[model samples]
Target: MHKEGDEIHIDEQEASGGSKEGVVRWVLAGGLILAVLLMSIVWIIPAMTQGDIEEEATVSGEISSMEGGDSTDSIVGIDGEPGDGGEVTQEDGIEVIEN
Candidate 1:
């Protein structure tokens, strides 16, 4: 079997250069899509947290507002015999002093 000179010699550039333009376009499009998605997430998280979203338009994994998050004062302290590891007795109430 005899092959022509051009057929026998395949340039290295031919192996990868043919699709360079297409690949670049795809990468740019992907970057644009990613930027848009990031912006939307940033905008949406605060909007949802601030109760800007209606009850029907709520998305999954949305952040809740912090209006009542400071109500952690209702958390009961560990009631036990006073000792190491912050153990407490019933007479000695545990008061969390948060300044």
Candidate 2:
């Protein structure tokens, strides 16, 4: 019952609606992608790059000062001295060693 021109007009309106929907979907998808990218840069980038701060040596300073030295030997139980046995004795309210 419809003429050719009327059929063509209906098809045109449907195509226009489809095009609008496609554009809206594309915009939403693009916004989502942009938000994800920004969140990654803001929240994730710093966490990924974070590391423990280390001591930086000056060019003229001696490297030996940075290295842990013979001070560890001063610890009593660590040296495995006789009668140490992971025990500290209390004498005069202070720890004294029989070794």
TM-score of each: 0.33, 0.33
Local error of candidate 1 at 89, Å?
A: 74
Task: Compose the digit string of candidate 2's lDDT tens values, residues 2-94.
Answer: 358546335665656655447888999999999999998997777666543422243323354446475543656754466777655788897
**Residue 77, candidate 1: alpha-carbon lDDT:** 38
Q: Model 1, range 55-79, lDDT digits (tens) per residue?
A: 4255442334334365454434343
Model 1, residue 92: distance off in Å is: 76
Candidate 2's C-alpha runs over 4 A off are 1-21, 49-99
Query: RMSD to the native, candidate 2?
Result: 10.9
